[model samples]
Target: MTVLSQEKPLPKAKTGEFWDHVQFGGGFGISAGNDYTDITIAPSAIYNFDDNFALGLGLQYSHLKQRNFYNSNIVGGSVIGLFSPIEEIQFSLEVEEIHVNNTYSDLYNNIKKSFWNTGLYVGGGYRADNVTIGARFNVLFDKNKDIYGSAFMPFVRVFF
Candidate 1:
């Protein structure tokens, strides 16, 4: 008497299959008021390893002005990881490092400051198609040095 085992081998991916799983996403914002103006642009690219996991890189640039009070520019980069346990929900972890440069001018003198800030964000959101809307809290937020005024921030993500 002899016993045999039966198992099927996994199929190999096609050459163009990699491109099908690649996605591009980011955020953009512009706000103008009587004494304040803010503009931001961030672009990112992600590669999906499967239906549930993705990793990506992003670049960000922001310009802010508050009339005669101050003028600042922020430039940074981030690494983000995303996981979807189900079709309607997604979780994310992102790490960002940014350089902040500011110039303050008054009737007496002008002062310049430059520094770097790091942020670690963990969040989850509702996912529909290529968009995700959620709020992320920064674990490493500091009031004196951080760019954002608050540790909690809302985000809208879109990928094409």
Candidate 2:
């Protein structure tokens, strides 16, 4: 006699699967000297739609001082999009906007200046595990009003 066996179908995936793909990453820095002080904090989160695509948001804050020269506060936010064409390469595009407030001091006077700045960055980097190292350029960089000395910046990112 011959017997026949049947296999059951697999179950479907549950809802709210999007939350499973979220990742977080950012960095901070602090420095102080007899005549200078700088502090920065930035935090960000991203949601991966798939293995190769992600969208995210970030926040930034910085405090800087030069004794008897200038003191400044900077606050900003950014929106970023990431794509990985292969396992080892990733590319990104980001838009950032920040407000800067500066107070300058001299022997006899104090001056205050405030303004908003925006940057559009395009970059690519090498990826390994949860880290990416690369350089980015600001398409909207203006040396006169931007905080960075140059339009190009190097970055290292880590996510889990």
Q: Identify the leading candidate in terms of TM-score.
A: 2
Model 2 lDDT per residue over 40-124, tens place? 9999999998889999999999999999999999999999999999989999999999999999999999999999999999999
Model 1 alpha-carbon miss at residue 76, Å: 0.8
TM-score, candidate number 1: 0.87
Candidate 2: C-alpha lDDT: 0.95
Error of 2 at 73 (Å): 0.5
Cα lDDT, all candidates: 0.94, 0.95
lDDT of 1 by residue, 101-138 (tens): 99998988889999999999998999999999998999
- Model 2: CA > 4 A from native: 1-16
**Runs in model 1 lying further than 4 Å from the true structure:** 1-15
